[model samples]
Target chain A: MKAYRLRRGAGRTALYIAVIAVSLMYLLPLFWMVRSSLMSAGEIFLIPPVWIPNPPRWSNYTKALTTIPFGRYFLNTMKIVVFNLLGTVLSSSICAFSFARLRWRGREFFFALLMSGMMLPGAVTLIPTFLGWRAVVPPNSYLPLIVPAWFGGGAFNIFLLRQFMRGIPLSLDEAALVDGASYPRIYAQIILPLSKTPLIVVSLFQFLGVWNDFLGPLIYVNRERFFTLALGLQMFIGYYTAQWELLMAAATIVLVPPVILFLLGQKFFTRGIAISGLKG
Target chain B: MRKEEAYGYLMAAPAILGFFIFTLGPLLASLWLSFTDYSVTNVYKFVGLANYKRLFSGADPFFYKSLGVTLYYVALSVPITIVSSFLMALLLKQKFKGRGLVRVIVTMPSIVPAVAVATIFLWLLNPDIGLFNEILRALHLPTSQFIYSETTVVPTLAMMNIWTMGSTMLIFLAGLENIPEQYYEAADVDGGGPIYKLFHITIPMMSPTIFFNLIMGLINGFQTFTQAYIMTEGGPNNASLFYSVYLYREAFTNQRMAVACALAWVLFVIVLLLTLVVFRTSGWVYYEGDRQ
Candidate 1:
């Protein structure tokens, strides 16, 4: 028994060492990005490379921000992100509530249709959708990006919220019904409040999706003034190919909001992913 | 009952409408457009499968080339991602110190924006004055011109892809957790070693999750565009011209909207067929509840 305990202790110690080493490997690129952002241009290109900046240059951020219209890009991204969150949360929850709580005709059929929609790759509809939007709105308008969210959020978001709503006790809605509360009232009060965790998860997912979307902006937006942060960064890289320090600075800035959101709501994020995997 | 039905329809109306307009409508329109000669100049002529004929008749070499590139990417990246994420999940499953922090570090890259991923990797993989090459030199190994060289661009992108295996890893972790500890306890009583338990227990139990990841990974891999678009733009002799990127170029750049539509339908057919094949052959996938 003593020998077994000693072996188990040694095994755990070795596991800790291995985990720490692998964690460092996973984090090294992010560390290098931050480190490079604070170094001088010449320091970045040094033969043996600087592991850490001797005196970190805080001005690289300022230079990078000023070099492009990052402020405008940030505002554009924020506007889209906010609208996307509202649209996804409002629309997905409503649709999900119906699927979960209400007795309706063709409910299962429509739900199956929604699930099938997830399998259709975006490329299949890229052109006609572009033409459909281009006919009504001018090129580079935010409508194409923002308006789709207002529709039914998205198939995935609806599916996620529906899954979460199904887990809520049916007795709550029945109680509300006994008090002569309408379906909308039940959805707004009982269902919405109870489903807060999944709602936040859906919103966070939408925020990340809109914030990091590149292909949508790339397809719809043409002019530089209408570019989101992702598009602006791409344009920045095109013009400043050799400017690694400033580029890293700009990339780091683009990375901040999602990282902050992840840090704040890591639990919901993991739970959401795990639930999706199981159901999927 | 009628009132409740109305409420359900009303609640689901917006999504249904959006589905019809944005998804279903475009899907049908694409099929119609694929046979025509549609371009940006508002000229649409029904050419009766000419675009598809072009795709097959060697008139458009880029179509086949892009398809090949996408297939290669899917083949390379999906297996690597599955194996690596499974291993990572197995590691994280252990009761070690600071395991939570390590899991977070590993999973963080998946949330990092693709544009930023492309940007960071562009510098990291630079042949000169790059971290990877520097490390290689330190170890007295040959440095590679990753992503820049024609031969290594796809593989390098595959490597970059493996860095974001956090989501799949988490899925595997979830799967691992679902596994009953009784299996391992039985294995222990049976005098099974580590490798014996791994093969006889862990792998068979986790097969369903592995299958799920494989399907999703294949789908996503075929749709890979943003990183290749940002980093290489299918350059250095079009070594990295993925199917979607090529389709996009045909639509927007070359003004061949009809051809692009045709390409889209082809991709749809291929993905659907592959998915169907997997579903048909997935008899080996073991689910916990279905004891058969």
Candidate 2:
């Protein structure tokens, strides 16, 4: 199709124009976010909205963090994030290894069955699960938020890891089996080492999910002591509804980490997304 | 073989057990609880469809309102995101300088958490001082109340969602990549123009991805919560009372556990039926090798 392709002239310029135009539509709002974050409260609502702030207010970040016990919230969020990340990575990989590498009766059947579990609305399980946990633990407990990771992480995560694991050369694992090495040993020493890319992808996804999760913390933790960044920002919304500068600052704080994480893991993120979407 | 089988079960036990306990058990329990008036007191009486009856019998003020609001959101947002993201993918598929940077910028919003996106949009959509209104005013275009206005809430929310559809566009890009080169070559040989190629080849090949995005979009859209819950709180006389919000308020705020359970089942069924309908009519989806 190179014979007919728009290799030059107005068409190439048109593609460039379209690309830059679309890119701007996404970037402009975020640019506004930073601008608003740096603005003084009075300036936030100025007519024709101030595009550039003279001497950007770096104080807003400090004030935003200090105003709402955001430090405590960050620590609280990190606790859930760390534990959830650990649980998800460990459990989901083990499960995926079974599905992808191990041959067993009803393997394909059970895998399909688990994948179908994604269709079940979280709402269906949400109430009963809450009741179960509330009965077992006190309010404001992180158990409800963290324990789900220990189970199987999530169906999607398991499927992702399994898909990645299935692509590994079977000969290495088969040689271990031929040498009478146990399945666990093979998984631990060979399969896990070989599956680092998907592992990172899964962990990054899990980190972002737990970090950004609002409803879980909302339903589970009622106290200020238990609030994650999401809940804290939510509470900030309530408290600083009129304070646009602080609101933008708080929102930006919550927004930045995940974007940084995505940037750091861009390659893996694309591959992970591609595999999950197309393979599904 | 038996040893291997046992090991497989052992390895997979956590997920399987978790599934039953967290997913399957609750699914059954929710179904059962939907028939009762269970509350936070941990005591209940089986109301025998009273809750569900209340839902459909015009007794529940929020039921229809929330459903309509969410469907309006889903209907608008799903298609908008699908077409826009597909177009984005198409735009990026062409060779261009700085396309990599453009790809990063396009996908950046998707990485932003929902709450943050809502906050940004809240400021951007603020009738008085938001950037959007400023732009609209500058362009001499009519500016509405955005998420604040009852009439415009759903559309505005839907529009904001389109901004963060980077993942959906990536899926489309992948689908675009998978199209056999020979088909495009053959079309070129037959003097088929780009427009003809897009209609005859590209759309058919992409139907499955489009379908996938549609179903997933609907499922996710119907559950629109974080943005609306944080921004609107089902306010402005309940114009933006999404079903998920209504359900959450019913369960947590109102202590209507059984009713919420019923709501959950209703969502499941609606999604299930929609998925089935899509699948049933998905004759346009061109699966490679299926015909042969």
Q: Residues A18-116, candidate 1, lDDT per residue (tens digit)?
A: 898888898999999999999998888888888999799999999999989999999999988888889889999999999888989899999899888
Estimated TM-score per prediction?
0.98, 0.97
| Residue ranges of candidate 1 with Cα displaced over 4 Å | A1-6
Query: Which run of 10 residues does model 2 chain B get worst, by summed lDDT?
Result: B124-133
lDDT at A142 for candidate 2? 97
Q: Each candidate's DockQ score against the native complex?
A: 0.83, 0.78
Candidate 1 chain A lowest-lDDT run of ten? A271-280
Residues B215-276 of candidate 2: C-alpha lDDT, one tens digit per residue:
88988888888988999999788999999999999999999899999999999999999989
TM-score of chain A of 2: 0.95
lDDT of 1: 0.91
Best model number under lDDT:
1
